[model samples]
Target: MQTSTGNKPFSCEVCGSAFSQNSSLKRHMQIHTGEKPYSCEICVSTFSQKAHLKSHMRTHTQEKLYSCEMCGSSFSDNSSLKRHIRTHTGEKSYSCEICGAAFSQTVNLKSHVRTHTGEKPYACEMCASAFSEYSTLKSHMRTHTGDKPYSCEFCGSTFALNVTLKLHLRTHTGEKPYTCEVCALSFSHIFSLKSHMRTHTGEKPYSCKICQSTFSLNCNLKTHMFTHSGEKPYSCEVCGLSFSRKSAVKRHMFTHTGDKPFSCKVCGSAFSLNRNLKSHIRTHTGEKPYSCEVCSTSFSENSSLKRHIRTHTGEKPYSCDICGSTFSQTAHLKSHIQTHSRIGIKC
Candidate 1:
């Protein structure tokens, strides 16, 4: 069948998306109407169009109807096969007028154009937040509706997005597709491996304006900024103590509940906090992962490495509140406080 490519005669009334034919517009309308007319016989999976149901059947049957002659690669649909062909031929028909950037598919080129134009065609009616892509807008809409369509068969867990669900499936399957080249370290997600790569590269991209301190991830920088700002958002209800980090508040909750959740497999030692359990685990394993660039010294805990750095820089940040005596370690300052107590007076 000849492909229909010309001025789109039909358009969607709900989202104002243009379509080539009335049939295409009708299929698009089902998205807004929540209507699925076509249903699969095997899985009972429903779709808006008969074509989609036919395509979905291939998943159950494990059939590949279309094949690439160049690479001998098989695909369920002709469109997918056509897109795969571009990889071999290096042919990109869809070109952006603004940037001259070419992409294999017209959809990708359209998404690329949005970056240059700053055009967000898809907008969330609930939040008024606009997105350059329709898929992103669909994900954003989930926040308002609290709907999770994608569900995991393994653990009865549901996710707002299919990609999130896919990642969650890896937890059950132990599928670590993303792997590091340097250390051969595997990650369930690509972003985790990217963040892991920064450890080897020492690439701290996210920086704080307050102290010029950098972090591997943006979230770590955000948490670090809370420390500089003295913003203790997470407050303990039992003790009325505020903490800058939610993890600290979580640890504090264990103190009230007397719940030791994190346990060691080796020695059966238990701890309230995960970080403390990880530190204790190092004692059994004798693993000193954190290393200093200067003098090539290593420590089991990150706090120990931090204190070791003070020896080189002579950075005595901890000060005795009673006697005005400074020390590199807080424990040293606490130990000196005893001396002041014996003297029968302090600052």
Candidate 2:
């Protein structure tokens, strides 16, 4: 039989779809036949195609042929190399037309688009709770299954993904390559440096339309919106207590489980939260970036500097109705009004 040049010779009669390659048409037929010809020699595993078997072989061989020319970083496959190229080029072609926010990958852009459209394609089979990504839905399934595949080599601590395991490894290595140019502050990851950069630039790009308040991080903005909406999606299965943030729920779980993973090396002090440990480290380093413009006084923390700024601005957003008096700090106002109230109800 003579094949037409412009026509699709291979077609799926079941779905009424056309394919350019005969191999693709053959692969499609496997859905009906349940045939897996390509089997792994190492294990009792079968794949529909030879290409899948070839890619799976690289996991056992640890053969990373594709490498980044700029950093000499290597990956096992060409697809990973293509994805890593965007980090060097800073080319975020996938953009949201609604908010003008760009993402490095199309999948991330599609997830962001769901925020505006309120579309959730991936749903839990156990519950009606939905997610934008299939990976998130898979992770959600683990809550029900109690499956933790990835484990730390040093410790027996298990995680969901290999990338998370790699991030956790940095804590043991004490390798903080991502450094700030202005303050010389180091971070374990590039994303942490990117978030810290916003503090120096004072760039709050993520803004709430309803409240007109802005935040440097999207996660912070989402948490802030919860204050207005009163939406607590993450709930405790044990006690039924809910939290807007996942980290809050994690910390709450620690309260129930009595888990304190973060510890200080200098004094051997333990902290429930990692950020509390980070703040405690600042006391040892004497690294105070937040400084006062009015006075030469500097503070080790941003919150202290924010309180000091109110003294210069003389702007007391919080007021006492009973005493008709105001103070710069909320703590100061609460203390001052304690003299007026009798039943521990300070004005």
Candidate 3:
């Protein structure tokens, strides 16, 4: 028996789509007709094809008929089971024409191809922002609506997306799933783990256009760009003092608010900024991390270490305005200022 090759034997009546076989044309007609002849017995849900109905029925029944012999993992369908088997076998049949990156499934390869093409099909109606995936666009919509649908049962914490909620749950559960293959150092967030990976690989993907300086994280590169632009958007409303980053402005607020959120666990010592708290912790631990190159003297704080370095170098940074006399510290220069005054006074 020979298969028909000259022309398409069947044609769809609804869409005028030609097919090689009558069965393909029949399946194509269901798209335009919206006819779902096959219905699941367990659930009220229906599907266009019997094969789809069979796959849907497994969700209600929780039946995993197809089992992998290598990993002992099971899947509802044979197609999913075949895809899972490829993970163990390292078989990637579907590949991208642009990048040549291979995937086990055609769907995954199609998604990867969009990266090279820069195709953002999913667009937000409220904003002009477009995303590569529908799920990303869905998450972006939450920002405009101020919708936090995902809520934690334990902490009463809310998140815009289910994936963010999943990550937040790890803080309570202490679940660090993303681990470094090199050192087994784990992080709560996937991005944190990716940032930590740069230490091992020495990879700096983010770079500054101004100085050509490289950074491991994109946010670091963003902050570095601000230094070149001399842009301080994050500013204090009261003092008119500005910072390149929001976190810097947040730390500066403690000067007015007198709020000390960061506290030492060992001692009851508190500090406004996290860096101050970290420096205070060294007092308890007796950890002098900053060491001088000239002398073997070590200091807990970096500022103290920098001041100490001037002793070895004999660098007089502070100078008198009236005379050419210089001092190592600012306090010494302030004392010298009184002698220059008509009436000598002490502050």
Name the best candidate (by lDDT).
Answer: 1
- Candidate 2 residue-wise lDDT, 163-182, digit = tens: 78889889888999999999
Runs in model 1 deviating more than 4 A are: 1-118, 125-128, 257-347
| Residue 126 displacement (Å), model 1 | 4.8
Off by over 4 Å in 3: 1-162, 168-174, 181-185, 264-267, 283-286, 341-347
Question: Each candidate's lDDT (Cα)?
Answer: 0.90, 0.86, 0.88
Question: Where does the lowest 10-residue lDDT sum fall in candidate 1?
Answer: 1-10
Model 3 C-alpha RMSD to native? 7.3
How high is each candidate's TM-score?
A: 0.53, 0.38, 0.59
Clashing pairs in 2: none
Lowest summed lDDT across 10 adjacent residues in model 2 is found at 1-10
Ranked by TM-score, top first: 3, 1, 2
lDDT of 2: 0.86
Native RMSD of candidate 2 (Å): 12.9
Residue 167 of model 2 has an lDDT of 90
